[model samples]
Target: MADTDDVINTGDLFQDPDGFYEPEKEPTFAEHRMRSGDTVRGDLLWNAGRTSAHYIEERAAELIQGKDVLEIGAAAGVPSVVSAIKGARVTVMTDYPDPDLVDNMRFNAGLSAAMIPANSTLHVDGYKWGNSVEPLLAYLPPNSAGFDVLIMADVVYSHREHPNLIKTMQQTLKKTREAVALVIFTPYEPWLLPKTEKFFPLAEENGFQVTKMFEKLMDAVLFENDQGDEKLRRTVFGYEIRWAEDQLK
Candidate 1:
């Protein structure tokens, strides 16, 4: 037998490991074309987000220009950036506090820096829904009531978070009748459309009024092979939520 010192430490070399290590995944991104002719990239650019940005530029320019605007669940912050370009007084873009997600949002914001107007300021923050709005509120001008507009894009798919979404809206939306929260989403899972639709009624119960704005059909479904009604998946639904008449008082 060989001496112990000469023995190689190759014990269990032939044995299969209990688990295999996977290499860290490199992040992937999708490119989006803004109405201003600039291109932005994100992990994935949901059609609802693109549509919301378009709506802001075309239909809601009056609401965004020179107003305090906040975007929750802002994946790439396209709408917030567009709002800044449109001359919003303050545009705050927020998403869950994941390093990768937040960093990507900041990157996109930086890319569009030159396009943003001198009078408008754009900020980025990591925020979770239903959390304290104070941090977000801090970005507003001194003595300001609250944001004039809130952008919610492609967020209602999570059926469980409806209440939390509404809570954030209540906390941050200004009480004035002109203040509005834009909730836009696509029913990716067609079967769950009813659950997604429940958000509007719940918002009404929470002292808000919901108005259906428009239904847009995109050129293609975001996920072509997704198991759902192709038409529903390609369609983007938009709504405006405002303080109920009583709440505005």
Candidate 2:
């Protein structure tokens, strides 16, 4: 594993390159019978308030209850925290190790501590995609097969980290045929929707199967002022990924 210090700062400079300076603020989202607030700093606000997040929040009982979840590039960890609140056996929320990003995730987790189910637990950590999974898997409960679900929201916007994201999914997701990864994203740059979507093919090549779950036209324009395909900015794509039958461990 690369030293955490040596890991490139992809979580900021690359993962969410479009994010820019904004005055410090606290943003909140309500979903899954839960509400969470985040301390916003330098990181892009990709937490559960977004349309993709709404999808997860709406399906919490079906997807999160009694499961183990791991969320990658979780800017404010809304889905992870919400999953824990909805009764996930365990929810690990991770982002880049940058003090600010990690600290903000912790703050958001704290915001919902009172709502976490008695049978569930929530943990926060800084994780660079494609890094060793041992550290993350270590958080699994004793005798757990692996994470029952993996959540990747908005992180797929970065064209360069596709493989790293897939690699992390392979290493951390449970091998059971039923285990799945929820990939939800919007092509903020409408013109680059094709490139942003290539991540699915790459995942198929790496022993996973991707199924289109839904496409939602969000009420809010993700990049209202950005110059891109307007239709793409307002649409959110959702997918369910699982190990191919032949690749199941």
Candidate 3:
């Protein structure tokens, strides 16, 4: 909704009655799959790669113990839910205009909020990354506890929104600035790497540092194309970024 080509209103899945999303019937890739029989495919319901949240959740559990957490661009919110499951004090899953992820996330809240019992919070809001700070800020009510950590995956799909992505984090993140704030990116292509580097100056301009926070390349395997070709590999890059703690103040 923030006018980005990479943006998809995954909330459309809710326009229909059933929660089931029938992603395009194509083979999934090995890296994106949790089980051998499964693959990352898109449907009217969920978007690409279902298992990345598990990794993000696992990683967050290590770094974010007893800290409030936020995952921007959380398509399905499984990672956020898993963070809650991991006993985080607070965790928020945010995305663009599409509330479909939040809709299902609400169900997750109902199912396990009592068991986890951490200060778990979830929301659906539009974040245009470096576009504007107001949109992302509007989601956090006044006197909110803010976030101690942030998480992301597969968000660097487009080279255009990189600036907004960096700026948005620099603006919206309340905690974990400077050497603490972190953003992770999944690999897209050889071209995407250089485009991401151009934002380093932008990060410095905002009084933050854009380090290669984290990188985890999963197994590569052939998957189907729209035309049913199996020549492509599951191309994804898992990454992270750290910000200075002073930026929030």
Candidate 4:
């Protein structure tokens, strides 16, 4: 036998490799207080969604009141809740068909039920972009053309889904001049902003006209230590998409 100092040392034989095992992480949430003073919680409460909610509250008479409204990727469903409160005839809030996400949206909707106008309705559902929109359309009044306004907050970040998003818009947006889709997002990963902006030109190519609405700077960045320009990360960009006159004909 060799001396103790010359003995080879072997680590735990049953130990897994460094990256071979990762424990499931607990879900995290972002909490926000709506204008009504009620707090809402979600896996994400993106600033872009808050900006869109403010815009809807500000322009309810023209954009939401008495209109059919749909919010895609409605993580927290704040804008949809506000629309119902503002008197939208029908407000449908949807997100990825994960049980937790859908349940969260429904919970938020239920929390604000008292604030919603008695004559108006707010519904929540799970949806995937580019999928059949028949279920969504069925929520509208019988013989209805389509939704009058579509709220899409913080969704363009998924560059790969741009076409699918536009496809959903084409299927759900009313053909009338008043129909519009609101697209809002922040460059969380500032370096990839160009990719996010590409959604507009793609929308135009899909027979829609794009209009820049506003750029808002929040008090603080969403990801404090995230890379790239903090200003860009803190800024929320807004746009409106509508069927081109030629396309509407």
Candidate 5:
């Protein structure tokens, strides 16, 4: 964790759970280390349960090369920065309203941008779920239909936010380009399947066809049964959805 002095040159520097500097305290999410690339400098909340999973990142960059991109639920901007670093025309890092991640994302974006050539532009931003695209519209041309690429990761943690996530994806995806939303989840309860279906159906209604691109295993240790014997049946899976152009029909 980078301190208020912006200089934590010693070992075992921790941000107290209440705050980064609340007199003497402890680091909440195990040990602290300054990471490289776009900085996305927030606290343990965003860092917790966060990973730059290969399946998600590889698919996102696969969709984003030579394209304009928007990454929703971009907790720490890892995918967004990767797209920018890969030469996407532009990449916007967006997430739910949280001051800590927002500032951290900006710092991270700056860190990434500094290393890039002079001709590229990669932007970082904050967005509220279920809102109109007014702020996001500034980047895309009017009636452009959709962005060249749209990506998300680990955003399927809830059943309620699924519809809103679909709506946001529809609003941001172009009619021609393959709009990809990668949701990797560890099924805590079976309820997620029905809720996921509810949200996924909206893609076709919004004039796009969706497909399951791929699936891979992930470590799932969060949800345990009453017995608490490491919950043998649960596993995390990654999904890639390719949203096709409505007009192609």
Candidate 6:
């Protein structure tokens, strides 16, 4: 419920003069894009941000075109923007639903509207993991099946939210064979990887099939002072999740 001004201050807390972490200069995602007049939100940059954007533009461009896409925990919503620009049938960018977060997403969407295809529609909504899907479902085309693709990047850091995240995916993703949820994450707390990896098994037990897509290591660390394992912090994991064949019944 915090206002946009409060969120701007929240973003400022990430910046430290001692160089412990490199915080993007812009205060918020919307402000950065509007000022730069760029489709990408460089101020809210993450290693996964660039990787996922590239994959969508270079590798998944064809697959994403004309597909219903939903992105969760999309702070900057860069990947979703990329998918929309690449021609998704419809794209919805959602996050914690805070007034500021949701409004910022809308601001970003508004500025990037021209890049989206005329036939493609982009929406912004406030959504919480494991919450009711009814509101989100209402946004889908009246006769549509379900979202064709789900995008989650750098969202697995919170160990407690894994189950809720999976549940949201289950309720929103299409059961079709080709529909998938792209779960990409980096273990900022490298030593906690084993705990983070538990999400895959949890997903399988909940009627989803998980496939490992790739492991990418970043060239730089987001936090220089955190004593977490370097390799784990820098390595990013990409997984493809789909409804288990039997679960469709």
The candidate that achieves the highest lDDT relative to the unseen native structure: 4
TM-score of 1: 0.86
lDDT of 6 at 130: 79
Full candidate order by TM-score, most accurate first: 1, 4, 6, 2, 5, 3
Q: What's the lDDT for all of these models?
A: 0.82, 0.74, 0.49, 0.83, 0.54, 0.75
Worst 10 residues of 6 by lDDT: 1-10
Model 6, 91-146: lDDT tens digits are 88899979988887787677677877788888899998878888888878898878
- Candidate 1 CA-lDDT value: 0.82
Error of 6 at 177 (Å): 0.7
lDDT of 3 by residue, 1-249 (tens): 133323322333213334322342332222233232322222111222344455544465565556666677765555565566566666666666555645644554454455454355545454545455564455555665456667665565444555556555655566444224444443333333555455455455555655653344446432222322112224344334555445546
Task: Sort the candidates on lDDT, descending order.
Answer: 4, 1, 6, 2, 5, 3
lDDT of 2 by residue, 1-249 (tens): 222224323343234344432332343343333324532122345432354455666677877888899999888787777677778888999998999989888987887798776899999999999888888988998887689999888788767787678778877889888899989887766676776788888788777899999887767764446666776677778899998988754
Structural similarity to truth (TM-score) of each candidate: 0.86, 0.81, 0.60, 0.86, 0.66, 0.82
Error (Å) of candidate 1 at residue 7 is 65
Under the 3 Å rule for N, CA and C atoms, how many clashes does model 4 have? 0
| Candidate 6 to native Cα RMSD, angstroms | 9.0
Poorest 10 consecutive residues by lDDT, candidate 4: 1-10
Estimate, for each residue in 94-206, the C-alpha lDDT of model 4 and write its tens digit: 99999998998998888779878789999999999988899999999999989999999988887667767888888899998989999998888778787678788877766
Model 6 scores a C-alpha lDDT of 0.75
Question: What TM-score does model 4 achieve against the real structure?
Answer: 0.86
Off by over 4 Å in 4: 1-43
Candidate 5: worst-modelled 10 consecutive residues by lDDT: 1-10
